[model samples]
Target chain A: MVKHKIVLLFPATVVEQPFLYHLVKDYNLIINVLKANINPRKEGTLVLELAGDKENYDSGIHFLESRGVKTVPLEQQIVWNEERCTQCGACTVICPTSALEMIRPEMTVTFNGEKCIACGHCLKACPARAVEEHY
Target chain B: MKVNRTYDEINERIKKGEAVVMTAEEIIPFVEEKGLEQAAREVDVVTTGTFGPMCSSGAFLNLGHPMPRMRMSEIYLNGVNAYGGIAAVDAYLGATEIPKTDPANTNFPGEFNYGGGHVIEDLIAGKEVYLEAYSYGTDCYPRKKLGTYIKLEDMNEAFMFNSRNAYQNYNVAVNLSEKTLYTYMGILKPNLGNANYSTSGQLSPLFNDPLLRTTGIGTRIFLGGTEGYVSWYGTQHNPSVNRSETGAPRTPSGTLSVIGDMKQMDAAWIRGVSFLGYGVSLMVGIGIPIPILNEEILRSAAVKDEELFAPVVDYSQGYPYGRGGPLGEVSYAQLKSGTIVIHDKEVPTAPLSSYPKAKEIAEILKSWIKEGQFLLTEPVEQLPSADSGKKLSPMKIRSRGEEN
Candidate 1:
């Protein structure tokens, strides 16, 4: 059976390096990293893409929990207030895994649970601060 | 007052292929030359270069000192005000007019006819200007040769072809920086079209061309020696040659290439230099944390990564891995309290080495988030504490709730 793939996201800083190093070293997993562009004016975040078996994935989560890190699961209703939404579409556009989609005709939006890697771009992009993770 | 490493020492390390950590004082000279202090003071925000101006067509590129070497100190500053020194300023130049062209006038062979006088005025005025000095549709001469207007439509097709080729190349770089990655991606404007244009004058559909869109994942981090990472991206059009009878009309033969073939000659000439400076800035910024949350820790990690990674990657080569110019070195004391100053100067020409380290750093940062180790630093007032017993009153309430 093929193992599942898990992704971890964090800010780019030294504080998180030790934790990431340990996770990468112990798990023997392939790590994917993301960060903001060169300009300081542009806002960006870092993402870690991990590929491994269920045990390794669970172990990574447990390690984060042990260190008091909050782990929000990917793709849930994520309560959203349409009033506060600027429709910047950062959530839909930056969703590396493509869990979110924009409904053009009705001007509504939808999210697919299975597709969400849970990078939390919607949380950052919503200028109105309307969207929040429900879990 | 100079702090940590002297200028000579830093230069030596840079010459020796090592990334020199810069301090605030060390970077002051460059900032002063760039006239950044006045620009920063006058504008609330600023943007510069092709990407800076094009992305915010109506905004100004705030000038900043080179990225400081002190890792922790710079981060503290950024944390205090995310928009302080690096925000985009309002544009002094007004709206640009896209010149209309007349296909009927075969005398001027091109799709657009930008007034020569207007073009010169914009360039001299320091506007975020874009021009195709050489293109099939337009003509651009040095300011001195403005009076000499020769009709190229009949005389030399080669001259017209070369000129158009040059302009297309220029626009490719400009569009890459202004349109593709920065303006379109950063501002979330999808109306802007891709850079690709066929000989038949047809443009590729939006998001269809990878060259016109940002790579799906973060590939690098821009280190700072002055302010932060400064980069440009775009496709290049290489004109092809075919044997035709002497009288046959010239066929414009070129395809728009993405950040493909990192080793292509023009790629090195254009993207390499733009990205090298960007890489240097990334190192500087990472080495000294800019005031975002957990900056100190991030700086430390970035420094460690730089130390480990710089040696392994070859700066002499193009893209992916390369060492940048000398890292400007400075001391901790200067960085903590002193301001990293910049004066006005012409933008420095492209750096020697071509490495995609900036992209690499960005990639690493993107992955770090996945690890769940990243935490945003909350404002001090927002943190719970005994001394600050008062809670933030409900926003958007105005007064005691009185329904309309």
Candidate 2:
């Protein structure tokens, strides 16, 4: 059996005792509060660190879903449109995840698929609508 | 009294059963009702101003002390986010560039230089300009000329958004801080100097300035060119009552009203010497209009009785004094400089009584107005005459007759 440590972050509004009561009762996983200061507009994400069998790790995904928690497996790919892209560096600046970085000297941009969190921050920030998330 | 009196003599028509043909005095209610309905359709225009440096050039200046002899050309070349508008910037480039491969071992240079300049022009001219700046091992110089031009455009956009965004963001942030300071100073005193959390989990600040402490809230709007900045300091409250019997008031009504109040309280509560600044500055050609209020006191004093009705000549000199008060000239100068500092420290402390320049401008404008060169127009329209209701009916009748 795989031992996974899953951490969930809560927005200030959801910190009430009633919400915690239902959450603690439903999940067998341990919960850890994130201490970093967060902007009110930002949505909180859960971080799960798993160590052990792959099968048990996969089962944990279903457990999270049963409690109405949405889960998306992260992927690494550069989705670009040949027609709409204008090669502006706006996506590079607004990407909180740092998935996109503009290469200096040439002033062109490059994407690091591995570092991408698929947050869609780049998409919203992009004026050209050139970037898309590939599965 | 005199034979059979006309219906006009009976204090205008006042028919009881035939739906009274009300005279002007009697139709006051109907007229007022229509006026009220018309007033409802009128749009309320609220405007504020901001002043700040935005974009890479501005950002560089704001980061620290001002730089001397900074040429516009240098800023255009090196500044990031240089372009004025995003739409203009987007028309010039491609998503990626084709990497140049080496024959030996098939190891490509880490830098993806497609070789050429004016790539943006090429892209716009229906040519595909695929140029990437990154490489695996070595640094890529994917067309140095293309990057130089593109950088200029980016810098312009950066300046546009930075200036405008900063203005708005700073206003809200400062306002938030002011509200928190007041709550802690007033209702929860003894702990006046101590910091505390608001009902909402935000911190408050205890202000050191006595003037700021006494004033529940203070707001200053500064307009410099097209850029504007607003700074507000004080307790968080909706409709920020100027005067109240009690210092504390009940929670205000409306969605986000409480949130606004909370932001103010929290901002004040945090007490970490909060300061926020935001405003938009045009990059290239856009010019913002400046509004000057025409005060009756200033106008009346400036214009001589003899010149009031004359065909005013040379109104330019008189314009300044006619609009602004004693500080009119100085304020105008400040507006042109494109910078307004609202905080106590930021505003000049020099006594206006002793300031010669300010006095000089005021005197000049005052003289011009007195010479009958300047005229002041009414800021608001007068109420319609009592006979207006009668005129409206006739006009409607005429229109209907024409249609038939």
Candidate 3:
């Protein structure tokens, strides 16, 4: 099974639709919503991790795009600036998935993008501004 | 054999490229294999380092006067306020000073993205910083206001003078409350989910000389990747705290007031940091070479992490309400082990101080001494001892407006 972090942008038109429920039931996928921000009658943005077979994952993306919802890889939006990181490990506690983990013995902080769910916690939680989110 | 070497004797060997030096971490194993006497007789200097957020830090800038100088009464750099009370062209910018327009906590958990610390970092990187100054027109100088861009090289003189730094030891902050706590200690998860600590453990400079035997006024040090000196005993320096048998303070104690030329400092060593919910602070890299004059000094310099202990404080109640400790005391060894048992719960632990960077700084300082470029200096006067009757005083609050 493949798990991918994707962000879904819902226009005001589709804000009331049942999109996540359909993705799980139709594609046989496991969906974990990391964060969701919706402005009443304006727009909505969702960050989620979806796990399924490769074919089902592709079909899920096609299904999402067909519903007038914009899909973007979470990796394309968030950046962990290694140059600015002092490896202080302050962001490690704030990160839920241990994505920003400190390498022991060396005590240096490293980011594993695969484990990140884009909760947007480490973006401002980082003291160095090393974690940036473009979206 | 007894070893009683003086600073002059050590400097003589350093001048001729014959001084033996080791970092604080390296000295531990060396002293373990060879005894303290042997290590003391052989090693000339033991270097120590710490890279952490020191909030009581700032820079003094002598911004060259504009063509029509007006005895500037107000000044700012990069939207952050600088203390303009010093002189017409001189100002002191503190690390935590945020912009006046910053929406600080009006919206809870404020994001202080930029501040004076960023300004200092930019200045040292040879980047242009926007400067704005205003003045009430004076007879000698008529210009009412000035706006210009300035660089570090253009300044008359720039120096970093931190009031308190290199805290000998600090508490391990945790949260016992049901809700999370956003603190200067970093974020503390609810119900003691995690613990956060700073200070480079054994590699910390003050921890090496717990009693301040060698580190004192006028002692040379590596500050922000440049040579600097201990200006004084730092503010709130309380050496009379609880201690271990080896003379290391189990609680936070002696601090150093350091000064260095900002013109010579490297941008990599001085960085701007923002703590979520808390304001901004400056992360400074400092390294001090402890002259191993005798076996006693060598023994102290070889102090290991296991011997160092810090109190675990609950930031939600204990830290903010009272300065009471130690939900339980844990050694640095336990702290570095990734988790600590607090109230029967295995809470994960993390350090705000970078051990790798601290080691890097210690290695760099060791190399400088080994290369005959850096020499040791005797402290002009030693810091006050734990038995010196020194106490950290608190401000007297006058509810009736009774002036002190």
Alpha-carbon shift of residue B38 in model 1 (angstroms): 72
Report the C-alpha lDDT of model 2 over A16-113, residue by residue, as the tens digit. Answer: 32433343454333334322223455544544333435554455556545544444434323465534433334355345556676443232456765
Q: What is the fnat of candidate 2?
A: 0.00
User: Each model's RMSD to truth, in Å?
Assistant: 29.1, 28.3, 2.2
Can you write out model 3's per-residue Cα lDDT over B1-404, one digit (the tens) per residue?
38999999999999998999999999999999998888888999999999999999999989987877767788889989999887888999999999888897788789898999989999999999999889998888789899988899999999999999999999999999999788899888899989999999999999999989999999999999999999999998999999999999998899999999999999999999998789999999999999988999989899999999999999988978885656989999898888999999999888998888899999999999989999888889988979898989777878887887
Top candidate by lDDT: 3
When 1 and 3 are scored with lDDT, the better candidate is: 3
Please tell me how candidate 1 rates in CAPRI terms. Answer: incorrect
Error of 1 at A78 (Å): 6.8
- In candidate 1, residue B233 scores what lDDT? 19
- Candidate 3: regions farther than 4 A off: A11-18, A21-30, A39-41, A66-68, B323-325, B399-404
Backbone clashes in candidate 2 total 52
Fnat: each model in turn: 0.00, 0.00, 0.71
Task: Indicate the worst ten consecutive residues by lDDT in candidate 2 chain B.
Answer: B200-209
Better of 2 and 3 by DockQ: 3
